[model samples]
Target: MNYRLKLIVSFALLISLAFGIGGTLLISSSYYSLLGEEESAIINEYETLQNNLMMINHFSSASSAQNMQELIDQMVERNMAHWQALSIKSSGETILESGDQSLILNYVNSTKEGTYSYVHINEGSSRRLLLYSKMSTKNDVLDLRASFDLSTSYKQWKSQLRMFWAIYVMVVILGVAVAILFANILTKRLQSLTNATKEIAGGNLSMRTGLRTDDEFEQLSRDFDIMADQLQENIQQLKEDVQRKENFMGAVAHELKTPLTSIIGYADLMRQGGLDEGDRLTAANYIYSEGQRLEKLSHKILDLLLMEKDTFTLRKISMRSFMEQILTTTYPLARKKNVNLVVSSDDVYIFIEPDLAKSLLYNLIDNAIKATPEGGNVKVIARGIKGGCEFDISDTGCGMENKELAKITEAFYRVDKSRSRAQGGAGLGLTLCKRIVDLHNGNMVFTSKPGSGSRVVVQLFGNMSQEVDYEK
Candidate 1:
């Protein structure tokens, strides 16, 4: 069933049931009240007749039936016309009477001694109340009866019943109306949510319910929107990751294919025979160089893959001692290239895996040396800063523009591809450096321009205690 109709029907039935019971009770109560009022009036009449008869017994000396009848007529005449009939019966005979004989007989027969009784009679077009009482008068006992016209009270009860039924129906109608209004509002909100979900299912991922109702439904809508946003973001991230992997695979294939082709071609030429010593030497050299390049590329690729699985144990190392060791290690290459190497530092320390940290520093320094020309300078500086240490490796090498700098850390990405290949670079150096720094929860920043020297700053977050403080 439609929810709105269900709500309306439920509400109407409930109201109708409640009002039906109440109306029935009300009609019964009104009927009983009319009966009670009629009874009270009859009792008052009986009391008056009893008192008047007692007075007549004390003062009047007539003593004959005629005198008694005359006295009863006067008494009856003095009373108001609240009843339709009055009667007095003695010795199985009615001495004086008015109104229906049958109704009075029934009332008297059914009446108990020393008590009053009443009966309702419907005589054609009118209803009547017959009241009977037995009383002792002077020397004889008499049955007195009266009939009250009840058509007015009956009409009143009918009117009251009609009014109650009307009210009950109105109450049910109003309840149904309110229920439909409430149901429509509720169903409208639910429909909005349903529509939004359908839109999302149809691939409109950005769809949302902008419901602002201050209720649970509104909160639910907000939560749904948040879930959709997160879902969209996660999907986009997954797509980018897949694209990156595809690009990485393609680059790896191309890099490997070049060296393998050169090595295979030259080796095939050497094996073809009849080559001179000079030609054989040149071919052999070319094959060896390409083989070395392929070897280096394989090791770098292995390092990249292993970095994903490797866990590191970190220890604190003094920045001054670490820098001195770095300088000692790279001095040979610096001297070979005739590039001046320098170091300056303040007391600082970093917490990192020694091997990974060494690799990171070595890669940066080697790249700096390769980029710097003969007679140019390369400076390594370490400094203590609040909560951490920083290292800057600046070189008077050919710097990269912004476009190249942005992708400098991507695998197999190089600004000067020819120069990088000639220097035996598979372009994984900065990528590895970045990974190591990330493993240590550090950051790297590069400042470079096309003509100016590039400065690579590495920030490691850790203790930066001074040497004197460390000793203490």
Candidate 2:
């Protein structure tokens, strides 16, 4: 059975059993107590009758059956309303009898003297309490028998039993109705939880059991909501991770295909043996340049993959020397691009993984130089802050729009795809730089306007800086 029905049935059965037993006991006890009182009164009356008969036999001075008969008649007439019958018998012969003689016959004979015996009897529609005794008379031993009407007491008992059952049935019915209502309320909460579970299983992760019973069920509902929230969050994260992986793979394939196609076409031209020496040299140079670009792309992709899975050690490095080295290395490129390079720093020791840190600065500087027009400025500045260091790389190049700045750190995302490809950019530079910043427990912020130059800010924290020792 369903839980609601089971609860109802269980409660109903218990109530009925308990009430039936209690009511039956109460009514039966009351009836029996009343009957007992009536029986005591009847016994008292029988004893009084016997005492009066003995007084007549002792004081009347009559030793004859006729005298006894007359005295018994007078006593019978005196209390005719109390008894159904009264009879006097001696030597197997009845000397005096009044009222129903059949009542006397129904009673078993008691011959022993000085002891009275009583019994209850049902005859037809009437009930009787029979009392019998043998008493010593003036001239003979007399057996006296009497029957008292107990029909009223029996009727009262029957009426009480019927009334009690009627009341008991009503109480049981009301109790069952209350039980059903209570069970429905309890099971309603459980039903809501069950429905929520089904909805979540069916891909509705936002389902919740909104119960507020101020009890254990409420606590359970809260816990269930928490579990659902966690599950939805984990599932969303998995989906995002999967989509990212797919995008990365597609970008990798596209990058490889371009280089491979160009290299193959040039090699096929060389193998055909129809081109002049200059044309052949041109094909070879094109093949070599594409090969170099492919090599750079492969290295950048490998670095990104390794960064995801590998841990690096950090060591203290002098910021002044680090910036000088970066400027010197990128000076050739900046000169070739005809872009001005400016540098500034605070002479502080900063913790970094040296090679990765250099790579990070190189990518940022290279992108800045490439984005800048001829005679435009690319500036790099580093300063020590509280417990850390910050680097600001700003370019007076053809900067980017706000929209492009938002997606610049996504893999293979380029602001100007043709210009980027012509400049031999695979669009992984900022993606790789972002990953490096994340590894250092740093934050990267990009602010740009369409015409105005863009600025990239890198803030590295967590044991990032100390004062340089000039005395040493």
Candidate 3:
């Protein structure tokens, strides 16, 4: 059965069992107690009647059975108003009798002389307590019988039993009702939780059992809500991961197709054998340049992949020396592009994986040099901060809009697509740079206006750092 019904039935059965047992015991005890009192009262009356008869025999000058019988008759006559029935017998012959003779006869002869006995009798609609005893007189021994009316006590007992059962039934029904209400209140909370679970299973992750009873149910609901939040967050993360992978694959195909198509067309021209030496040389140069672009693309893609799969160790390195190393490598590129490369830094030792850190700084400085116009300045600055260091790279080049800054670190996301392609940029440099920054437990922020220059800030925390030792 359902829980509510089960609770009601259980409560009702328990109440009925308890009340039936207790009430029956109480009524039965009360009836028997009243019956006992009646029995005692009748026995006392019989003793009193017997004593009066013996006293009469003692006082009178009587020696015959007839005189004894006359004394017994006098006693019976005096006490008949208090007794239901009375009988006096001598030698099995009835001498005096009052009240129901049949009832008296039934009990009078059954008891032996010199022995006393009392019993309860149910005769038709009446009840009685009968006492039979033998009284000795001077002339003879008399057999005496007396009875008490118990019809009223028996009738009251039956009435009480009926009334008790009636009240017992009502109280049990009331208890069952209360049990149903209590069960409903408890199960309602369970129902709410069940519904929420079903909704979440059906893909509605936002559902919640907003119970506020301040009991275990409330605590359970709070925990359930927290679990739902975590589940939704994990599912969202999975979806974003899938989308990024799809975009990455599509960008790789497009980048490879452009270089491969051009190389195939120029090689086909060389194969046809119809061009002069000058034209053939030009086509070969175009092929070589495109091949170099493809090589750069492959290296950038490998760096991005390795950044995700590999772990690195960090060592203390001088920031000034590190910046100078990066300047030396990119100085040729800056000069080739006719752009000024400037570096300024506080001498500080910071912890980093040297190769990965160099790759990160090189990509940023290279991008700055490429973006700057001829004779325009590309500035690099480094400083020591508490627990770490920061690098700021700014370029007076063709800066992009504020909206473009957010996607600049995304793979293959270039602000000026045609300009980027013309400069042989596969657009993965900032993407690789972002990944490297994340590996070092750092953050990168970019700010640029359309006409003004763009500034990129890199902050590395969770790294050991100290001011450079000039003495050393």
Give the C-alpha lDDT of model 2: 0.86
Of candidates 2 and 1, the better by TM-score = 1
Candidate 3: tens digits of C-alpha lDDT, residues 93-151: 87777677776666544556556787878978688877788867667777878777889
**Cα lDDT of model 2 by residue, 296-371, tens digit:** 8999999999998997767778888888989999999999989999999999887777788889999999999998
Model 2 residue 277 CA deviation (Å) reads 3.9
For model 3, the superposed segments whose C-alpha errors exceed 4 Å read: 1-154, 172-189, 212-218, 311-324, 345-351, 463-472
- Local accuracy by lDDT, each model: 0.80, 0.86, 0.83
Q: Candidates 1 and 3: which is better by TM-score?
A: 1
Model 1: what TM-score? 0.84
Q: Candidate 1 regions off by >4 Å?
A: 2-6, 11-42, 45-79, 107-112, 118-130, 149-154, 214-216, 310-313, 462-472
Instruction: Report the Cα lDDT for residue 205, model 1.
Output: 89
Error of 2 at 171 (Å): 5.3
Q: What is the TM-score of each candidate against the true structure?
A: 0.84, 0.75, 0.76
C-alpha-based local distance difference test score of model 3: 0.83
Candidate 1 colliding pairs: none
> Model 1, range 21-96, lDDT digits (tens) per residue?
9788979897989867966776787677655655664455655456656666676687644667777777777777
Arranged by lDDT with the best first, the candidates are 2, 3, 1
